[model samples]
Target: MAARREQDFHWAAVDRGELVVQQCRQCAKLRHPPLPRCAACGSLDWHEHPLSGLGRIISWVILTHPGGKDAVRRTGILVELDEGIRVVSNLVDQENAAIGARVRVEFGEPGPQRLALFRTLAETPA
Candidate 1:
């Protein structure tokens, strides 16, 4: 049997320790929340392209309420990747993530499954 390809490319990127996004081979357009076909050109030909793993914390929300059974206990962020793909994911390795802070992708077990979690990147002294 073929390997269980992830329905979401974000998960697939996590598996590879890299942040990636889908791009249409025909129109050369970038796409987020991966789909089976290109939304711009309606082409089936596409490929996964690695991102810079750099992004800004556009917006975030801390969930105080539980999501019921099987929900991973964590905070969420609506990060905008360097390539301009905005995706919602859990932020990790920080006491608190704030808006406009630099974040990078880190793979870890958010629940029973491994996933891509964003963390604050160290700032270099100027």
Candidate 2:
């Protein structure tokens, strides 16, 4: 499969330091990995809904690229947003990572492209 032009808005928003998901115009259901049509209502009409950039780590995994010139390891996390949307993003600050840790979106240049990575939220002084 190849990248679709419909997804350009997503990367463009990321470039602008904004996180967004596609909201179906018909059913108002939000979905990540922007699709051309809504799976729920089969509606082609949709709009970009800005995310809170807040979520909790529901799951995670450490991925190691073995047997490659650029072999490296990184932690990937599955976060369920406060709005109930689940997104897969990489964790930057892996120090206090836990399954239910609170995290927020942080943009970073992994290579030449800006991407939405995440990090554990700082604990408040009590």
Per-model tally of clashing residue pairs:
0, 0
lDDT tens digits, residue span 57-87, model 2: 9988886666553444578999998999999
Identify the leading candidate in terms of lDDT. 2
Top candidate by TM-score: 2
Colliding pairs, model 2: none
Error of 1 at 50 (Å): 0.8
- Clashing pairs in model 1? none
Model 2, runs deviating above 4 Å: 1-4, 68-72, 123-126
- TM-score for all predictions? 0.80, 0.88
Estimate the overall C-alpha local distance difference test score of candidate 1.
0.78
